[model samples]
Target: MKIKKAFPPKIHNPETVNFNEPPAKLLERLYSSHMPRSYKKVVNGKEFFSKLDPNIAYQKCPKLKELLDKMLNLAKKSQSTAT
Candidate 1:
């Protein structure tokens, strides 16, 4: 019988700094621009909180929420115009 070798799973340290990671401002912009609110028929309350990064999500930041709302509204308007 041939013996098979087992390899340990790769583990990544969450605390380790990753230079490849996008900056917080960019992340915030991306997150806000892409968050689904109108199409998903959801409000920017608890559901939004659940979908955001826990570390910065609970800060109750209004700018990010405003950006998201703006993006969602624009998408909805364009969608309506298309149809």
Candidate 2:
């Protein structure tokens, strides 16, 4: 005759198995609302016209320095307006 050994059943918390909530919900709970807004502005605004390199400006359009200067002035105006 052969003898068999029984193993214990696995136990898990019910909360760990469920993912009914959206991933954003977790982030929202963990961080303030301004966090997401600031993150987005930082990411998107990095591509804003002001950050472009002066060297590449010439290849992008004619009279690049003048164009870049105009863009910078406009950006400054907008920023001042916002505040």
Clashes of each: 0, 0
Q: Candidate 2 regions off by >4 Å?
A: 1-53, 56-62
> With candidate 2 superimposed using the best TM-score fit, by how many Å does residue 76's alpha carbon deviate from the native?
0.3
Report clash pairs, candidate 2. none
- Which residue runs does candidate 1 get wrong by more than 4 Å? 1-59
TM-score of 2: 0.28
TM-score of each: 0.32, 0.28
Q: Each model's C-alpha lDDT?
A: 0.47, 0.47
What is the Cα root-mean-square deviation between model 1 and the actual structure?
Answer: 17.7
